[model samples]
Target: MSIESPRTAIVGLGITEMGKVFGRSAVDFAVEAITSAVADAGLDLSEVDGLYVNPGIKNDTDMRLQSTLGMRDTRVLATVQGFGSSAGQMVQYASMAIEAGMADVVVCVYADAPLQEGKRAGAAYPGQARAMVGVGSLPFAAGLKAAPERYAVAARRHMHAYGTTSEQLGAVAVAAREWAVMNPHAQMREPMTLEDHQSSRMIADPLRLLDCCLVSNGAVAVVVTSAERAATLRQPPVHVWGWGQAHPGYVNRRGSEFGLVTGAAQSGPAALKMAGVSVDEIDVREIYDCFTYTTLVTLEDYGFCAKGEGGEFVASGAIAPGGSHPTNTGGGELSSYYMWGMTPLSEAIIQARGQAGERQVDRHDLVMVSGNGGVLDFHSTLILSAHPKGR
Candidate 1:
């Protein structure tokens, strides 16, 4: 479906105090974000007919939140989960529902409270060995009971195949840190350099502590409605031009295409095709940076650069603030908050609405947002614009 006027738009956005804030459950953040987003959209809870909720590491669910928020009589209500990909999937489903007349207004939210007072961030995600009790996975048998180790292997495979270097991955980290300094809410805002990235202690072989995303406690939510309905409401509408998803299951070893290629290849093309735009048309990009390598490989997968050339593409500081490719303008999950895909989704909206403050790009016409889940297994892409457009 394509039209000159966008059929659906995001009318409201709410983000709680992300990062290490303590003493609040994921449910608390969910209600806070949902209510605030509704208010931002100039709507009442009673008028909202649809709701989408995705839990985080803490496992807060839609059922718990609906009751906590006193939401009832909704036409569409369900749990959306594809790990990190849920954020984009929720918007895609909400848009489809609104177009089909299933519901008028839908709110999608994700919240997690994994940080406890005095506990280290690593404690939030314990060893995966317990989770692999019943299974005899190759990774588990090899004592790869943690995420960083698994990802390190993937990074190693990419490096071995294409001769990617640490400094190249460090470039992505430096760029994200550069963007973080501009965002007030980012967790790690200190100025960083390739040297700093190299100096940071290694979590697993090629991956350093700086390369991984920060663990945080917070929530991010958005309200979606028809463009016509949005124009009659509060804040300017962020048009939903197009969206797409791909889930390429990961194999534990280097024998498969797991580390080299990701879902961005298919999903990016699909989303851009639906949005009626090209790579060059995107003025800003908010990519999920669960890890620095994730950002680099994803850039290559999205056609921003050729496969196996992500290292050279990012080493030029192009993805930084004063460069050709503006990416992760809100600091991204690497240095910014990590609320799954919401980190990128929230920033995408902020940029699309021209509310990024110092980090705002002059050209805010088109923004590309990506979501990745698992070990680069699940992926989803969204193309957004400030002006209404056909899908």
Candidate 2:
């Protein structure tokens, strides 16, 4: 049975370079991409009706990104601090607004100048700031360190419980690097071996340096509106089928287990149900890869594989290009530019649009992208297709 299509579409997308970004401010990069996106969609600046920014660690009101981009006139303006995971939520909001006649067009954008110096250099929004509160201080108390501790224990437990190996975990880095070799924008394009992965210095007990995602500077933006209006736009439109967010409510050392199984696992089925699709029905995936452990945990949570089988599943190379179900073909955060996993969200849209260039999939009809934020405290998932299937 052919599913009926919905009335929302992603009409445009834009991305900044992914690297050290020594000089350009994050908001500046975002404006560059968004401007390109508006032109690409054949829409004038006056057409935009809403603005949503990620407001990452390097964000500041001084940049006045909304006004600078000439989107301040939009009827709705929103600032969210949840990193890449906020993509789905913003899209959902835009969908709702379009459905209710609140706005005709919405653009979601995120950028961070973490590498840029000044008072804003280290000024992440308060929630993200709190997550890293202890890093630069006396004893290194940031959640970056704390998250690894929790994952080290989880990895150890998974190793003991499922016989997963360090080599198996390293395979993720290896496979991602392999795909990175094809992505011109990826930062760590050079290949590495499992031995290289295992031999790399350890940040946490089980996490080698290679197992972590690089911190780079970049911005990504996407434009959304009613599917009826999108059909008249310059570019093809990809529809949103389903969307959801889940929070696991785990935060500190004492709540390790709760945190491990938080948002990703719990909310995945709900999202799939809303989309009226199963895991096997998804042709492509863009799971967040802030860390190897994150990918490992999210795969299981999202029902891609049986619990505790993520290591083996990833080792099968299913996530690489030309696999049964490719994921993060733009190299993901592990190899691609990182705006705290925001570009992956945009890349997912590109894949659904069938414009992935070198990394395009073979006849992908459905795609899913999951974003994890706040030590896994928040999870947001989006289901997209070339044509919507009645949400």
Candidate 3:
């Protein structure tokens, strides 16, 4: 099924306080976010009949949330298990359900409290050891590697092919911090210069400590309903113009066709095509910034610039606040508290609605949001607009 026209819209958004320690369970945060979203939409919980959640925490299933929240009318329940890449998928599924008449009001949510449990966030995955090697199966070597090392391999390729520099990568980190300084909920608000980014300790070669996203504790929720219904809500409706998802398979291991993972190359065009808008029309961008290189590669793949030109493009400060194309005004995952990619999505919605306070941009009509998951294995994109379809 294709969404040629904007039929569903995001009517409400809510986020829990972000910090090192939330001192609560994932469900508690999810409930809090959902309650805020429902109230923000000027609707009661009883009116919600659908739920879409990213199952980050163990045993955090849709049924568990439904039972806990007493959402008796929930007719559609789906758990997108895309890890950091699941945020856009959650919104996509909710919009699909609402468009299909399976539900009227669908609430999409994500939550985690890794710090409070004394556990390192994103460290639970046991790579490669669980994979069954066979013909056409991913090699055992693929399983032996983790995210930082895998992304480093790609970064090295970009440097070799395009003469990209660590300073160019540092530009992304600095820009993220520049925006974070204005975000009260941001975890790292200290002024960060390209020099500071370069000085940070190296986690993986070519990828410094400042290049990575924060391990944060937080939750986010968004309410999706028909555009007609959303028009009657309390807040301005952010129309879902288009969305697309792509899985490019594992690109870190040996004998891969692409060598460098570029799933956004496929997903971005699909979304833009569906939205019937060119890249030039996008006023704001919230690309996934799991690392600095992630943003660089995505920019090229998304047709923002020519291939191998991302380094120079970002170095021009075009993505920084007040630049021609403002990106991640909410600080993104790099400087802001990382609730996976939900932070970026929330920022996109805020921009679309003209609700972003200090970081608000002038042209708030069209916004592009992207998400990446599992070592660049999966990618998703969404185009949100301030106006409804055919307006």
Candidate 4:
């Protein structure tokens, strides 16, 4: 059965300080974010009846947060697992709970204390030898070993197929850093150029150090409630018009079709269709940017440009501030704090609420936010608006 459209709105947003070391546990960050969000929503912690969390690098669970935060009425507690792509799904769970009358207000949260955890924070996949054997004759053995290696193969393939240049990939990194300079919360605020991106150490072939997302320690939380309830809150409601999720299966199983496309091809259109809007109506785009190629391919998959034409689309600076399409205004994961996809979702909400300060877009009425999980295996898309539907 098809799930009903989300009728909820994000009435509050909160984020803890992001950096290399917070000297605090993940639960501490989660509590701080939830408290801030509750206050921002003009509600007491006791009013929260639902909780959604994606504890990446954190050992905490939903019950722990509910107890620590004093959410005595929390009726719906869920933890979604999609690796980095779990943030958007958290919102989906909250919306579903609210729609079903299981809860009145829901808080979606994510927290990570990677820096404080030291070497344990940077754990690599174990049993690579056995994994390679499982792949059998598939050539993806090496790429499957790590994220960078997988994306590098995709970048190389895109270059060979469409003549996409390394400079084009560098343009994506440069544009993100450009936005970063304006974002105080961005971890890497220093101005970066295409030359700087090209000169950075190569992590995996075409993917450079600057092209990858940051290793950050932080927490983000957003309060979700029905539109009717949000109107009485202190903050403006960023209405959730539409949302869609898709999985393209595993890369190793998909074979040749694996890296050639992303799940956004399905999720993006589904969200727009559900919202009764087209791509051109979107005023802001907050797509996941785990890597430069991730952004490039996602743009193409979202129908922002033709297939294999993402390089030219971004190279034209269309995604920069004041451009035709303002994307990842908070510098995205590339320059912003990498709390999975929470960084982009938070930026989208801020822009939709007209609270983006200097980086705010001229037209902030509509926004399209996308998230990627696994090795381009899972995707989620959301369409948000400044005003609720029919308002």
**Full-model lDDT for every candidate:** 0.88, 0.74, 0.83, 0.84
Q: List ranges where model 3 is wrong by over 4 Å.
A: 57-62, 117-145, 250-261
Task: Give the per-residue lDDT digits (tens) of candidate 3, residues 49-142.
Answer: 9988885544354546888888895789877688766888888888888878889999899887666455555563333344565744454455
Report residue 310 deviation for candidate 3 (angstroms).
Answer: 0.5
Off by over 4 Å in 4: 1-5, 58-63, 117-144, 250-255
In model 3, what are the clashing residue pairs, if there are any?
128-143
* Residue range 1-391, candidate 4, lDDT tens digits: 3554567899989999996765787888889899999899998888999998888655454546877876675699877787767877888778888888899999999887767544532342221334345547365554456577877887888888888888898888888888888888889888888889899989889888888887677799999999899999999999998888889885445355666678999999998988888998999999899898999999899999999899999999999876888888889999988888788899999999998888888899999998898778889998999988862
lDDT of 3: 0.83
For residues 1-391, what per-residue lDDT tens digits would candidate 2 score against the true structure?
A: 2223336888888878866676788777788777877777889878998777776656652235677876555677778766558777778777777777778888777776666444332222222224334435433353333445555666676677667777877877777787788777788888788889988989777777777777667777788899889989988788887777887776456536652464877677877777788988998888888777777778888888888888888889887776776877777877777666465677787788888778788867888888887667778888888875654
Q: Rank the models by lDDT, top first.
A: 1, 4, 3, 2
| lDDT (tens digit, per residue) of candidate 1 on 61-84 | 565577677778888888888888
Per-prediction TM-score, please? 0.96, 0.88, 0.92, 0.93
Give the least accurate 10-residue stretch of model 4, judged by summed lDDT.
Answer: 120-129
Top candidate on TM-score is: 1
User: Positional deviation of 202 in candidate 4, in angstroms?
Assistant: 0.6
How far in Å is the alpha carbon of 259 misplaced in model 2? 5.7
Q: What is the lDDT of residue 323 in candidate 3?
A: 80
How many backbone clashes can be found in candidate 1? Answer: 1
